[model samples]
Target: IKTAVEKIDIDVPNWTFVAARLFLFDLYHRVGKSTHGIKGEPYCHLKEYLKYGKEAGRLIPNLGEGYDLDDLNDYIDSDRDLLFNYLGIKTLYDRYLIKNKEGNPIELPQHMFMAIAMFLAQNEENKQQRAKEFYDVVSKFEVMLATPTLSNARTNRHQLSSCYIGSSPDNIEGIFDGYKEMALLSKYGGGIGWDWNQIRALGGMIDDHKSAAGGTVPFLKITNDIAIAVDQLGTRKVAIA
Candidate 1:
């Protein structure tokens, strides 16, 4: 996956846009960790297939070569077996498990989850505890975030989709301000929920009665057009609802 990302061609604007979307939002949230050891909780738990391999009489190739014995033992120990439930185990294999270039599973469930947990908890002072807390939260149903939030929280891509507000008055400058907010939201891959209702209805008194107001629908169409023009890298979308 790392190789795929490195070699991915970003020349096509649309492709690049989509890649940017996933890179900042989807992939980051989904990936527990990279082999390079950057802590990311979102992508951490994508490694359950390796255990399946052991059950099939296949040892993870090159289990211990350059690593410390204690580290290897800690990583390879069967304690990870206790982390997941039956359904989570099955889902990990079916959807989330990442594989090597040769299609061999390179991730284990605990490693993957811990990697993602760490990524999400990167802001915490004690990363290990934060990662473990994240893992505990995700392991159960106490709290859950959307797929995009889950994918991109603590990475280089600060693609957090929550709320977008556009403040427009009755004048052109107000319209521009709203448009600017929309553009900013698009850049950050956030869904915009504009309160166009605040915009005065057409032919209504506004701005100390110097000018008439444009109705909500016309400005609504204009706002909609603005959204259409500025695409949000595909990770988030702007809609009326």
Candidate 2:
């Protein structure tokens, strides 16, 4: 992987694909040894993979239960794995694929895309067809999903929205509640847009007791800490605005 990555330059940018293939080879070998002992073929047992993810608590318990495993497995086109370049596949491997408690990836890029499609289309009238359509566009790189949707769609966390917007009112309870809400949302891969303009400026009066407020900077510092502490389950740091 190091050799292939070093070979990539402006003159030979396609080496990224070579590096991706090498990394994928290593990933497949690791997953196979850890799971089914079948190297070079990561998509061989779709049903078993889903079951293992559920048992490991990386995936929702009901994942793959409503679909025909045989059909879904057949629908998975391993050829689509070729669509991803190095950075794309690496990002998916690092952040999106479901990992066990031991922090090893249990699903491949195609598996992640298929799982997202299945979870999203599970409630449709013709769910099997809808799932196929979703898989087709996503795996082929014809559409892009938001970060949270890509990361949490098939996982037990399942908070698939991109971001949330809310206001922090100008009261003690409301300020703390806003902080708590941001923490919870960040825990599940959601970005936050908080309206803190209502907070008093520096040295403002607090109430009838003639207490002085420390202003929004102190509250903003708390939010900054929350962003660092709750880092979206290690996928990425929280984004706050």
- The lDDT values for all models are 0.49, 0.85
For model 2, how does the per-residue alpha-carbon lDDT over 5-66 read when each residue is reduced to its tens digit? Answer: 88999999999999988888888887776677565566766788888888888888887767
For residues 28-90, could you state the per-residue lDDT of candidate 1 as single tens digits? 333333233245433232233333333433323322223233432243323433444334444
Query: How much does each candidate deviate from the true structure in C-alpha RMSD?
Result: 14.4, 1.5
Error of 1 at 66 (Å): 22
Q: Which residue runs does candidate 2 get wrong by more than 4 Å?
A: 209-211
Tell me how far the alpha carbon of residue 30 in candidate 1 is from the true structure, in angstroms, after superposition.
16
**Residue 2's lDDT in candidate 2:** 91
**Which ranges of candidate 1 are over 4 A from the true structure?**
1-116, 139-142, 205-212
Q: Candidate 1: global Cα-lDDT?
A: 0.49
TM-score of each: 0.48, 0.94
